[model samples]
Target: MLRYVINRIIVALPVLFGVLVVTFFLIRLIPGDP
Candidate 1:
């Protein structure tokens, strides 16, 4: 059970990180705020 949860988390982490990276780039491209 714990291992399953950990595995799921490991898979999710990259997806979440990717979303964050994409959002960051989109904000930077659109806002160009400093």
Candidate 2:
């Protein structure tokens, strides 16, 4: 259903943001510049 899809997308947004933030920091923490 359209509502279900929208709800899923809303829920996934925060998780995606978290992943991006964590990945960014992890890459930044690498020994050599990435």
How displaced is residue 10 in candidate 2, in Å?
A: 0.1
Q: Candidate 1 residues 1-34, lDDT tens each?
A: 9999999999999999999999999988895647
Candidate closest to the true structure, highest TM-score: 2
Clashing pairs in 2: none
Clashing pairs in 1: none
Over the stretch 1-34, how does candidate 2's per-residue lDDT look in tens digits?
Answer: 9999999999999999999999999888887853
lDDT of each: 0.95, 0.94
State, as a TM-score between 0 and 1, how close model 1 is to the true structure: 0.79
**What is candidate 2's CA lDDT for residue 26?**
84
Find the 10 residues in a row with the least total lDDT in model 1: 25-34
TM-score for candidate 2, residues paired by index = 0.85
How displaced is residue 23 in candidate 1, in Å?
A: 0.2
